[model samples]
Target: MEKRWLPLYGNNLEAHSTIENRSLTDLLNDTTAKYSDNTAITFYGKTWTYKELQKFSEALAASLNGDQFKKGDRLAIMLPNCPHYLFSLFGTFRAGGVVVQVNPMYVARELEYILNDSEATHIVILSDLYPLFKSVRDKVPTKKAIVVALKPGAEIELEANDCLFESYLKQATAPAPAITIEAENDLAVLQYTGGTTGVSKGVMLTHLNLVSNTEQTYDFMFSGEVSPPPNARIVNVLPLFHIFSLTCCNFVTIRHGGNQILIPRFDMPEVLETIKKEKPFQLGGVPTMYVGFNQVGKYKEFGLDLVESYVSGGSSLPVEALEAFERGTDRKLCEGYGLSEAAPVTHFNPSFQERKAGSVGIPLPNTDAKVVVETDAGWEEVAVGEVGEMIIKGPQVMKGYWRKPEETERTLRDGWLFTGDLAKMDEQGYFYIVDRKKDMILASGYNVYPREIEEVLYQHEGVQEVIVLGIPDPYRGETVKAYITPKPNSTLTSQEIIEFSRKQLAAYKVPKAIEFREELPKSAVGKLLKRKLRDEELAKVEAEQSS
Candidate 1:
C-alpha cells in the first residue's frame, strides 16, 4: 500500500521523519544547556528557568538516589500541574526510576489498584491528597510518601515515616549521581489509561518512546518554521498526568525551550486572567475547554488573539465546537489523534498545511498508519475510504502494557500498535475518526456510529451537551439512545429532540430513546464518559429485567 501522507509532508518536516535514538533525559539536558537562562516553567506567579529546572531536578534525583529509590524502581507521582509534579517527573527519570503518573483526582480505590498493579515503591503527592493515600496505604506496596505543600511555609503533620517534599529536596545540594540508561529498552514512565476496553492498564513507555514522541510533536507543530522561536510560551491548563499534556505541554515545551504557564486546574476566570497576563503563544486543551471558552462570552477580552497555535486532543473534537471556537478566536483549533499506547501522539493536523475541519489530519512524519479490517484468518488492510480499525507503526508507540502480556499481545502485533479506534482515511490520506469500536451501535444489522448521531444533536440550538449510546432492544439487537443536557432556559423536550434528529439522521441511526439530564458525566480532562453512561443504561435494563 502506498503511503498517501508521505507526499503531503510540509517543507523541512521530512527531516524529522526518522526516529532519533535519544533519551528524554538527554533531550532535557541538551535543552537546559542551550537555553539555560530562558524561563522553562511558570506556576502561579514564580518562574523557573531551564537551568533552575535542571538543577532542582538533579538535586532531587541525587536525594532520591541516596534514599530507598533506585534504578528501575517505579515512583508514582500523584500531584497536579504544579512545579512539584515537574520536579518529581524529571527527578524520577534522572534517578533511573520509572515514573508512574497517577491522577490526583483518583479516589482511594483507584489509587490502590494502580499502586498495587504498578508495584510502585514511592509516591510524591499533594498535601491535601494525603488522606486518599493513607486510606489505601496498607493495601499497596508504597514504601514512602512525600507530601508537597501548596503554599510556602505551610505546615503539614506527617506520619513517622513520611517526609515533606521540601525537606526531601534539601537532602542533596549537589548534582545527581551518574547513571546509565538504555533508552529503547529501559522503561521511563508507566502511564495508566483505560484503553478501548475500559480496563485501566499501565502503558510502559520507554525513554526513547517519549523522546521520539516529543520530537515528532515538535516537528509536526513547527514544521517549516524556526525552531524554538525566542521566548515561546505554551499555556498549560490540562492535567499533567494526562498523556496529552505530558507530551504536548511538559515535554514539547522543554524540547523547544518554551515557557510553560502551568495552571493547577481549569477555572475559567483564572484561565482567562492567566492568558491575559502571560500572553502565551500556544494553547493546548480538549474539546470541552474550547467549548467553555466559546461560551464564556468575554473570552475575546482575555487576549486569546495572542495564541498562535491551538492544539486539541484526548478525544474527538466536535465540528460544532471547533467552528464556534474558530469563529470566537479567529484561529483554527488543530485537532490531533492519539491513544495512550503510542506515547499518546501519532497524528496531528500539520500547522503549515490546510487543516480539514472534521479530520484528525495525516499521520506524523515517519509514522505509518493504515485502516485494517479484522478477518477470520488475520487482519487485512482495508481499501482507501473504508472504515476499519486504525493501526500505527512508529517509534513513539509504547513497549507494551506493564505485566499484561496477553493484553499487550492483543494490542501490539508485529511492530504495529492496534489502536481500537474506528477511522476512515480519505483519498488525500486525511483520517477521520468514526467512533470507538466498542461505542458503535448495532441496530437491525446497521452499523450506527454514536458520534454521527451526537454530531447531529450538537447542531440543535437547545442542546448543550449530549452523549449517544446503544441500549439493548427486544426487536433490534441494539437501539441508539441519546442522553442530552438542554441549554439554560431551554424548554427542549424529548419529542422535539427526536424530531430534530430524525431530520438529520437515518431512521436506524436516529436515537430511539432520549433521556434529558441536567448534565452528563465527564472525565477529569473533560472527555465525555460514554462508557459510564452505557454502563448506567445497561444496569437500568438489568434492574428492570430482574424486578
Candidate 2:
C-alpha cells in the first residue's frame, strides 16, 4: 500500500521517515507508473494519457542525442502552453538538462538577453514566435539550434528550413535513460523575474526545491482526501512561465492526480464558457482574473455549482472581488503569498479550514517562517505579531539565483531565505502580508502598501483595473497616486473614482490624483507591472510639479 501523508492536528506532519525517498525525475517515473492510463494533459479537445506522455518524453530525449549537453547544460524553452511544451519540458529533464523557462510573449530584446546570459545552446519556440526570434537570433551568442513547434489552431506551414516536431518524434525510438540524477541540490529550473530594480535574472530552483514546495501546497489543500470524492478538476489559466501557476496548477496537480483544464489566455467569456462546460471543482487565479470574472455579471452562465475551492495568488485578492465571486458562485477565494525565488508557493490558507478574508494564511507544513528585524547589530527574530521582513527556511527554498553568487549569498543566509516581502504573523499563526519592501510608498513620513488603496478602488463597480503607486511630491515628500483602467463602455470619470475611493481609503492612503487608461501594462506572465507604471507616472508627476 502507498503510504499517505496526513496532517497532524491541523499542522504539517513529517513523513520523510516513512516514504521511499526519490528525486523529481524519480517522482515523474512514479507518476507514469501509477497513472499510465490516466489523462495527464487536456487542451483544445486534445488529451495526452500519462503512458503516451511518458513514451513521447523518453523518445524526444533519445532523439535529442542529449549526451551532447552536460548534465546541467541549460535548454531554453520559449513556447506557450501546449502538449509540445509539456513534452519538451519533461524531455529536457529526462535528458539531464536544466530547463530555462522563458515567457513566449517576450520581445526580441528580452529573448536575446536571456539566451545570451544563460548560454542556452538550443531553443524550442512556437512557430508564430519564431519570426520575433529571427530578428535577434544572430545577436545572441549561445543559440545554435532553433527548433520550432507547429502552430496550433492553424494550418501546418512546415518551412523547408524548419524541422517539424512530428518528424523528430518519428526518429526517436529508444527508451528514456535511467540515470541516478543529482536532483537534491542540482538546478532544475531557471525562472526569470524582472521589476523596477534591474534587468531580468534567472531564479535557480533545484529539484528538491520544486518537489518540496509542490508537496507542501498539495498537503495544504488536503488533496486526495478520503471523505470527499478523490477525482477533482482544477482550472488553470495563469501562464506556466509564472512560478505560481507552474507550482500550483501544473506541478501540484500532477501529484494530486487531478485533471487540469488549461486555457492559454484568460478571456472572460471563454473562461466562463469552459467553466460551464467542465464544471471544475477548483479554480486558481490572480487578483486580475478574479476581478474580471466578477465583472462578468452573467455569473450564472458559468457553472460554478460544482466548484469546491478557489485559490488566489500573484497579488492580493481584493475584498470586493472575493465577495462578489462568493455571492455569485458560493466559493470562497483563499489568498496566499509567495515569490518566484521560493519555488513560487510557501504559504496558503488551509483548503478545508476557516479562511480569513484579508489574511494570506499560515506557513506551509514543515516550513519554518519568522519575521526578523534588521539593524546594525545584524538580523534578529522579531516578536510574534510584529511587522518585519519575512524569512523562510525549508526544503522548498531555492538553491540560489543562477550564476550570481553574490545575490545567492545575500538571499540565502544561515539556511534561511530572506524574502524582501513585509508581513506579520498573528497569535493563531496566520500570516498577513504588509507589502513588498520595494513597493512601499513613503508619503509624509507614512508608509503605505498600495494593495490597501487598490483594494478600496476595486470596490467601485465601474473600476475594471486599478494599480496604486507613489509619485514624487515635493510638498509631502511623496503622494499616493492611482492608475485605473475602467470597464469597457463604462463612462466612469477620474474625479468620480477619486471621490469614491476617498470615501473608503484613509486620507494618506487615498490617491491625491488619478489617471484613467484603456489598459494597465502587464508582464508576460499576467502580473501587473507596477514598476513600469510607476516609472511612467513618476516622470509625468515630475514634469507637472516642475511647471
Candidate 3:
C-alpha cells in the first residue's frame, strides 16, 4: 500500500526513518555534556544551565539510589511545571526507577488510586499539595514524600518519613551510581489518563518509546527550519505531567539542547508576559490556550511575531479557534493528534508545509497509520475519507497497559496499536479526528460524531464553548444534545444555537436539545470534559424520570 503522506513530508523529512536506541537519561547526558553552559530551562526569573540541570538531577538520583530505590521501582512525581519536576523526573530515570506521572490537581481519592495502582514507593510533590497526599498517605504504599516549596522560604511541616527536596538532593554530592538499563524492555514512565471513558490505567512507556517519540517530534518540528542547540527557545505552558507536554516541551527541547520556558500553569497574563519578555521562538499549547490567547487582544502590542511556530495538541483544534489565533497573532497554529498509548504523538502537522485546517496532518516519519472498520472476521482497513478507528504501528507505541495483560492484548494486536479515536483520512493523507469511538452517538440508526456538531457550534458568534453529547431518547435510540457556554454577557438562547447548528450539520446530526451553561468542565490541561457533561445529563434524566 502506498503511503499518501510521503509527498507531504517536510523538506528534511524522509518517508521512513529509524531512531537511535537510547534511554531518556542518555539523551540528557549527551546534551549536558555538549551544551554545558547553555541555558536548559527558564522558570519565572530563574534559569538552569544544561550542566546545572544535569548536576542537580544526578544529585537527586544519587540520593534515591542511596535510599535503596532499585531499578523498576516506581517513583511518583506530583509537582506542577516547576524546576523541581524536572529534577525528580530525570533523577528517577538516572536511578533506574520508573517515573509515574501524577497530576498535581488530583484530589486525595484520585491521588490514592494512582499511587496504590502503580505501587509507587516514593513521591515528589509540591508543598501546597502536601495536604492531598497526607490525607491518603496511609492508604498507599508510599515510603517517603519529598516536598518542594513552591515559593521561596516557604516552610513545610514534614512528617517522619518526609524530607525537603533540597535536603534530599544535598545528601548526595557524589556522582550517580551506575545502573544498566534495557531501553526496550525497561519501563521509563507510567502516564495515567484522565479516565474519561473508564477507570484510568497506567500507560507503560519504555525508555525506547519515549526516546523515539521525542526524536520523531524533533524531526517533524525542526525539519527544514531553524536548528536547535541554543537557537530555539520553546515556551511550555502545558502541564509537564501530560504526555503531550512531556514529549514535545520537556524531552524534545532537551534532545535539541534548546531552552524551555516553563510556566507553572496556564495563566493567560503570565504566559503572555513570559512570551513577551522571553521572546521564545516556539510555543506548544492546547486549543483552549490558543483560544484564550486570541481573546487577549494584546498580541500585537506585545510583538508576538517572535513566535515562529505554534503547535496545538491534547484535543482537536476548533477551526474557529485556529483561524482566530492565526489572524490575531499572524502565526500559523499547527494542529496535531496523539494519545497516551502512542507515547503521546503519532501525527503532527508539518511545520514547513501546507497545514490543512481541521486536520491532524500526517503520521510522523516511520509511523504507519490506517483507518480500519471492525468486521466479524476481525478488522478491515477502510478507504480514504471513510471514518474508522485509527490504528498506528510505530516504535513510539507503548509496550502495553501497565500490568494489565488482557487489556494490553486488546489494545495492541498484530503490531498495531488500536487508537480508540475515530478518524478519517483525506487523499492527501491528513487525518481528521471524527470523535472517540465511545463518544459516537447512534441516533435513528445513523452515526453522529459529536465533534462535527461541536465544530459547527463553535463557529457561532455567541458560542464560547460547546460540548455535544448523546442522550437517551424515547423514539431514537439516542438523540443529539448540545451543552453550550455562551460568550460572556451574550444572551444566546437555545433556539439560536439549534438554528445555527441546523444550517451546518445534517438533520440527524443536528442537536435535538440545546442547553445553555455558564461554563463547561475542562481537564487540568484545558481539554473540554465531554464525559462529565454526558454523565450529568444522564443523571438529570434519571432523576427526572424517577420523580
lDDT against the true structure, per candidate, is 0.83, 0.72, 0.84
> Candidate 3, residues 255-274: lDDT per residue as tens digits?
87888888887787888888
lDDT ranking of the models:
3, 1, 2
lDDT per residue (tens digit) for residues 1-547 in model 2: 0111123223433433122345566666787787777777878777878778777777767766533555777888887667777787777777777888887766565678789888886677777776776777779755444455555455445433445566665665565466556667678789886433434668888887788888777767663231113446677887777788888888877776666778877777788888888788778887767777766676666677457777888766666667877888776678887888889777777656667777887677667788888889999877777899999877778877777888889889999998888888776777788766767565543446677677768889898998888876543446788899988889998788778865654455668888888889999998898889877866887788699
**Model 1 poorest 10 in a row by lDDT:** 438-447
What TM-score, computed on C-alpha atoms, does each candidate reach?
A: 0.81, 0.77, 0.81
The TM-score of predicted model 3 comes to 0.81
> For residues 109-182, what per-residue lDDT tens digits would candidate 1 score against the true structure?
56888899999999999999898788889899997998998977776778857899888988775567788999
- Candidate 2 weakest lDDT stretch, 10 residues: 1-10
Q: List the residue pairs that clash in candidate 3.
A: none
Error of 1 at 133 (Å): 1.2
RMSD of each: 11.1, 11.1, 11.0
